[model samples]
Target: MLHIRVITPASRTDEVLRIAADSPAVVNVLKLPGAAFDPEGDLVEFDVAREGANAVLADLKALGLKDTGGISVEQLDLSISTAAEAAEHAAPGDPEDAVVWEELSARTAAEARMTWSYFAFLALAVQIAAIGALLDQPILIVGAMVLGPDFGPVAAMCFGVLQRNVRLIGAAARTLAAGFAVAIAITLACAAVSRLIGWIEPTMLDDRPLTSFIIHPDRWSFVVAVLAGVAGILSMTARKSSALVGVFISVTTVPAAGNIAVAIALAHWNEVGASLVQLGVNLAGMIVAGIATLFIQRLMWSRLGRHDIAPHSPEVAAGQPTSGRVSG
Candidate 1:
């Protein structure tokens, strides 16, 4: 169930009210006239079952309520509602689910536009990579993978393609490229510093067999990438974020790339080339797997009709401004 707050101009209050009243999924409707100060509109509040949320929102949007006044859909914590029984009884079973490509695209773009912390995270990832190389430790390599923030943009790119949002695709791609460039540069610099201190020897690259994980290209690496991609996407859509830990372990991109940077800093040409190959293999595998996973999940959701999860109404909160558009 979702709580929808609809705010519409005085002239269109009647139409909005009628829509809510007639909606079978709406269990309670409350109206507060002359309550809106900014934008000066009436407020209409209602509760709708999750199954019918999409339909109700679409209908209200067609009425131009969102454009002229406002419509906001907020997910309610079901634990507090005293009318839980009534709400459950009124709730429709999962409806046919369809992929809202546009919504998914918007979501991807929004996530890509992360704050400066993203850069910091990248820097930390490079440092971890440097550490892994100096100590010749796979555990540190894995830690770097978990620390890398590269997954956000990668996931965003996959989502953008699924939704066919060019803007999202562009934004995600740009962020991803920029982040990696920075990480590689930092890792290279760290490698140089380690060499200067004699903490790491350039010749060690020729003998270190464990570092091969970064550059080894094979079928199994692709398989790992595909599996990681699926797990990453599922973590994003579902509420289980802890699953991403497993995803981090599955993909060798960050660790492999970091290893390559360290090898390059040490002037190990052979290792550098191999690490690059490993990075490429991991990337290709993840993208293919991510796209496939998204397609399958959408198909399943649409068949279940779980898309409708909010009411169509513009209710401007105390300080919240309505953008008048549905963002994924």
Candidate 2:
């Protein structure tokens, strides 16, 4: 379930109340008239099932409350009310299966930012993977995979494509490109310094038994990437952090990136080439599969939710703002 708080102008408060009262999936409606100080208006609150949220939000948005006042939504981790249960029962589908596009957009938008912490995590992950590659330690490799944060932007890029959001796509792409470049550069510098100090050798790349697959791209790599991509997007949309961890472990992007940095530092042209190929394969597969997964999800929800929404008033039916018009 989701909790919605709205500050609507006096002129639109009736319509807002009507929207909340009309939605079968909404309950515990409360309104405080003239309570808002900034963008002063009525403060309306309600709880709506996740499966029915998109429609309610769409209608509220159509009323232009966002421009006149405001709309805020927060997830309800626990709702013990019988009314909440009834609301869920009234909803069309399971909460976990619901795809709240605005929530997704907000999440992905934040993740796609090229913040300092983003670079720090990515660079640190690459260094860890590089060290793991030199030591031929699968355990450390797995640790690096878990620590890697590249998947966030990749998934953001996928969502951007689904929404046809050019600005979002550019932001995510730039974040990915600059992040990888910075991470690779850091790892490469660390490798060069380690080589100068006799801490690593070119031969370290040659005798890996368990970790050599990082540089050897084949059909299986693409297949695993595709599977991970699907799982990753689903986890994001469903807000399942546990499933996201599995997706992280399933992709080889970070390991391959580490291999490329180490091979470049050691002047192993063949390994570097192969690792580059592995990296490309992983990225391509993930993007392709993520986009496809989002497309199918959008289609499924649009069909199931078509008849589940409350009826639109004449104002809403006049096409002020249709469904899926506002992106976060």
The number of the candidate with the highest lDDT is 2
* lDDT of the structure predicted as candidate 1: 0.69
Q: TM-scores, in order shown?
A: 0.79, 0.93
**TM-score of candidate 1 relative to the true fold:** 0.79
lDDT of 1 by residue, 46-151 (tens): 8865555655666666667656888877656663565644554554443223333323444566668855888788778767866776677888888888888787
Window of ten residues with lowest summed lDDT in model 2: 306-315
RMSD of 2: 3.9
Deviation from native of the Cα of residue 252 in model 2, angstroms:
0.8
Q: Flag regions of model 1 displaced more than 4 Å.
A: 14-28, 48-52, 82-106, 209-211, 305-328
Model 1 lDDT at residue 66: 55
Best by TM-score: 2
Clashes per prediction?
13, 0
